[model samples]
Target: MVGLVLEDWASPSRATASGGEYGVLMYCAKIASRAGHTQRIFVAEFRPDSDTQFVSVGIKHVRFWTLAGRALLSKKGVLSSIEEARMQTMLSVAFGANNLTFTGTISGDVCVWKEHVLVRIVAKAHTGPVFTMYTTLRDGLIVTGGKERPSKEGGALKLWDQELKRCRAFRLETGQVIDCVRSVCRGKGKILVGTRNAEIIEVGEKNAACNILVNGHMDGPIWGVGAHPTRDVFLSAAEDGTVRLWDIPEKKMLNKVNLGHPARTVSYSPEGDMVAIGMKNGEFIILLVTSLKIWGKKRDRRSAIHDIRFSPDSRYLAVGSSENAVDFYDLTLGPALNRINCCRDVPSFVMQMDFSADSCFVQLSTGAYKRLVYEVPSGKQVTEQAVIDRITWATWTSVLGDEVVGIWSRNADKADVTCACVSHSGLNIVTGDDFGMVKLFDFPCPEKFAKHKRFLGHSAHLTNIRFTSGDRYVISAGGDDRSLFVWRCIHAPH
Candidate 1:
């Protein structure tokens, strides 16, 4: 695992020139594997006498692949294959009534897994990258919208049956990129499609023709579109920093409100009584559904809001930001916006977050490498040593001395560990490395680790690593390989 070290010192020479003291902060990060390699070093000087200015004198170097001079680990896994494209646009996880979790990758594949084991993979569901996916309420049919490939004719809106087989495809004439697709209601036979050119096209399930096309936004591209749960009303937000509500059947604008910042995302509460708008300027506002008035507003100057979601009970709102902070607000209390708790100081930006079915916990994932779980009301961390327990088998050499350490120091060179996860019991840990390998390690291993096993399936950088709820298996995903691997935990305690 990579380590960060920081130190501060007083620069006597610089102090003498300015007739005052100045501090120099030194940050050193080392990626020590079986092979000796230096990754990055950063140094900053702070001068408080003038304007408290900070100047940096360091270059960042990142190694995405393994270094040379090391023996490769043996391949290990029950299943391995290429399943999707190189680039992915989105990912959605849905649960069935039977407790089965289905993951749909925007690379145009819908995969069904049972406890980290791949049960099925629906290949080539769309001709190109899928932008949005939704399941209908009647027969659980999946609706997908995406841009067509260059070889293809135009963009498509497709519907899949219960078994994930393509049932119908709708041909669109606009030929614009579909940014968001949503179903108006259960068994309504009407689907709403938002395009990058700020147009909202309503299409019917039985026919391939557009029912209505409305210019949703005038200034900028539409970022989000949401439908009301019980009414024919829908909401759209755009880069113009405005949120507008429209009536579908009436084909007219119902209300409009400007948020004074670029509106990046919007969502309506499941109860249909409130709406949340996330802005790009680190501000978010809550509006009343009936009166369309601002209920509350808050801001985080560190980063912009990326996504917003409400708990299953519609009582708590989870606001994820680019600064790795997740704030939970209690909606039961009035316009004061009582902040129940917050999960802050994470390692990376919070790309997506979801509340548990019971609304007791929230699960969040970052852009590159971190997955965290925290209790809702108490804001207590549920993941035990997730970041520090990651163990990489590599040969790490000391810069000033001849000391060498790591799990594979005796046999192999070095590997770059990308992501990691610890089991709920805190007895085991799983790590994904740049060589597309997933390895399991015994927690609290000796300095020269001896107990470890490898799971090899991906042929690219392993971007994600996760453990099943029961810690029975490990789920991993590759970065450019576009493949999802499910490995059975052979050493899981029985």
Candidate 2:
């Protein structure tokens, strides 16, 4: 086994109660392989009297070193880059089964990563921040839309081929901010674009000709658009507190349902039989597709509903809110809309969520650090010490306080889990942290300090982490780090 050392130095002005300067430092050591172990060490210096903390790191075989905190690689791990300006924020991400990942950034660049490494950077792909992105049915084709800048025509739609090369650009004459875009038609040759001006623009990918299909929302901006699975119809949710269903072939509005609240997002069930709408007032509603009759509706009252998605099987609807909670509703429960589970008190605003492919679990991401996973139908939290802590409380209370006071375990470390996801099999989970560490934990982590594997390459807070379809690898990105890292996983016994 190789040994790792850590050192800390404190300034003389920051003396402790004992009249001496004090500091805290931690070190971890792991076997590199079966032989020729590699040693990695890091030293952090803290001064209570100063506003800054300094860290230095070194790694043996990789020959990695860092001075101060600005160097690319530190003793922690190798820093990956796309040879472009540091990304401001990761606005959108898309994955391909071919091991290709595409990310859009606030810097107006679209980066493509293969096997978790940055392979291509489409620099300045837009005039302003890339707000939305979509991947076509064809493997390599991607569509990106951005906000308008002061001097340049913004809200333009651009298409790129597989090599991160721009193939076509379509400029929207409406000058409205494009909020969302989707591929329409069976061949994926046409695009559907939604704008804040309450317009749904349908344009051809080859000709780039814009045709206004609907401009009916008179009240407010349109936030979401959903295409029907089998029909030439689509649904649009607007801040006007209504959902409009339009017939593409007829070039007219077929129906409009007043949801009574500003709708932020709408999603059609996989079978196209139901539509779920999320409102700005935290009201979630479900309606039958054909009749446009309300099937069920519920209000959370805590915060606005930001997103809603249906499980792959259309068995459940997951609602995410700004209040840091995710509610799972079993669609088969009818008028009761029977909420099977509620994951509440997440560290920050719930920004995104997705159900496992098997519909066994739901994964959620927050605005801050940390991700959470919970079991479907059961509502049991499978991440952190939530479930186990409850059990421990019950067991400990059953015994007399004096009998177990001396034998209790130490407190678990506090972590602001920002974003998390469970594997398809529901066997493993990966989470990103505010400190830029991506950790792998066993499902339903029974203990606060459960056995976990850590991957440390990012030097900034991690914004997103996800497992590949087969659960063979994990892809992580840090907005501050401006890079993506992929790690291979060694299966553990369930």
Give candidate 1 regions above 4 Å deviation: 1-213, 246-253, 384-494
Relative to the true structure, how large is the alpha-carbon lDDT of every model? Answer: 0.54, 0.56
What digit string (tens of lDDT, one per residue) describes model 2 on residues 1-494?
Answer: 11111111110011111111124446886422221124432222222222332222222221222234433333322226645434244555544446555666666777665544556777788766665666653555777777544334334577767776677767665444443342222135788775554456788767767776655564644555555655656677776787877554454667778777788777778788989998998888889887888889888655788678888777788888888778888777776876777786678776666566577766555666355667775767786555423321100101011222221124513334444555545666666666756666555454545555555555656555555445554545454543334454555354
lDDT of 1 by residue, 69-129 (tens): 3432211111224454222222444333332334445556665544333556676666554
True lDDT of residue 115, candidate 2 = 41
Task: Report the number of the highest-lDDT candidate.
Answer: 2
- The parts of candidate 2 lying over 4 Å away from their true place are 1-216, 230-232, 246-253, 383-494
Instruction: List pairs with backbone clashes in candidate 2.
Output: 148-154, 369-417, 369-418, 370-417, 370-418, 370-419, 371-417, 371-418, 371-419, 371-420
Pairs that collide in candidate 1 are: 33-394, 33-395, 34-394, 34-395, 34-413, 35-413, 70-413
RMSD of 2: 20.1
